[model samples]
Target: MPDGYSTLHPAMHGMVNIGVRAARRAGEIMVRHLNRLESLEVIEKGRNEFVSAVDRLAEEAVIEVIRDHYPEHAILGEESGASGDHEYQWIIDPLDGTTNYLHGFPVYAVSIAVAQAGTLKHGVVYDPLRQEIFTASRGQGAQLDGRRIRVSKQISLRGALLATGFPYRITASRTDTYLDMLRAVLIETAGVRRLGSAALDLCYVAAGRVDGFWELGLQKWDIAAGTLIIREAGGRISDFNGTDAFIESGDLVAGTPKVYAALSKLLAPYARGL
Candidate 1:
């Protein structure tokens, strides 16, 4: 058993193994497609949003792995949408940073999360470029490449390094509010990073690489895996309202306990009605 797996829920052992397998398979597909980006077929899902042939192929590979091991399990894939509707569902983002991958920015990842009755049970985020795998099972604690990891010991938001994502749509309605929150954080914290991949950003928080992370307009697949990992790593996560509604609202705030509270306080006033 792995270091963190010793404390994992007994029933979750197999599920976590399956998730890691699926994520790794997807990672392989992603890396194989990297060298041939110029010839890959790409589609504009919407303004500033894209889906590539590689994304579909990777998603297919992930689902195939899950189905092979647990044919009855449900799946919610970024490229395929929801399927099966079982008590056990796999949430997948075969390529979390499509734009970054397309640009060969080397910050993308494969994210796989499992949930039972809407409650997250296990998560796996695989970075193909770095060959690092971050895993977490409910109550088991998080791990980076088989070594246990935790959130930064930073006690407060002051001087804490944070990571975030810009709303890609960039609509006029939310622009000012987002910028205001960003400006406030930039002044109060050591610095902020607008990383392209939310899945990896959350993992970085879990691994103590960054003290906190927040983002808007995220799908469940993007944050699901990272959410479990961060919680297991002893970090706190929630929406701007300081509630568990982040998954529904697509507005997230997460950090070490103290940092989370401070950041949430700073961003809440600006998130009214969001």
Candidate 2:
């Protein structure tokens, strides 16, 4: 256990432990197969949506750990789908950046989050390539490899680095709308990055590597863990309308308080069907 675990409440600590265990297990599987991508099987889940044998194996690795420790907890996984029916649900994205991973880009991650009664309680995002583990409990704050982390204090969008992702469903009706918003942000910010991993993008916000992040068409498994980590790291998150509906809306903007407010203002028009 790390020194930060000594400060977390018992239950929260246990959840974090289990989550870290699961993420590490899955991450190990990913790392082991990282060099053998050419031999792996791949499938297209939807237009531009992909899955691979590595994703299935990693997801099974994660589910196995969670099931062994908390058999009754429901699981909502990207590869395996949902299992069990309990108030406690574990959301798992065994491999968050599949496209990048398939291309050997070294930017994917294993994301895990435990939510009780629909409220996130504990979360973890582990980068197998970088060997970075980001964890957070609802009120226990966020940590990066045992050290406390916080969002950047950048107060303005100008000169602030931002991160974002383009929805995989580029042929959808809203692609133009999304592109417009991206253009606006790119013109106003110091730089904008498209990392292909929503989980890592949010973790970057928490680690202060990026001042803010926004994205669309993300699933619960994509943002659940990272959202809790950001909030606990002294950042704010919400839908384009500035409501607590981002999780359900699949559209989110997050950053330090001031940066969040600026993003909200810039994105509000697009959110309103403009």
Number of residue pairs clashing in candidate 1, backbone atoms closer than 3 angstroms, sequence gap of 3 or more or interchain: 0
Candidate 2: tens digits of C-alpha lDDT, residues 1-274: 4434532435458878888888888888999997899999999999889999999999999899888989989999988888889999999999999999999997999999999999999999999878788999888999998789999989999999999999776445678788889988988899999999999999999999999999887898999999999999999999887777878778889999999999889888876772
Tens digits of per-residue lDDT for model 1, 1-274 = 3434422435447877777777777887888877899999999999999999999999999999899989999999999999997999999999999999999998999999999999999999988888788989898899887789999999988889999999977567687788888999999999999779999999999999999988887889999999999999999999887777888777899999999899988888888845
What's model 1's overall lDDT?
0.88
**Which regions of candidate 1 are displaced past 4 Å?**
1-12
Error of 2 at 25 (Å): 0.8
TM-score of every model?
0.94, 0.94
Q: Locate the minimum summed-lDDT window of 10 residues in model 1.
A: 1-10
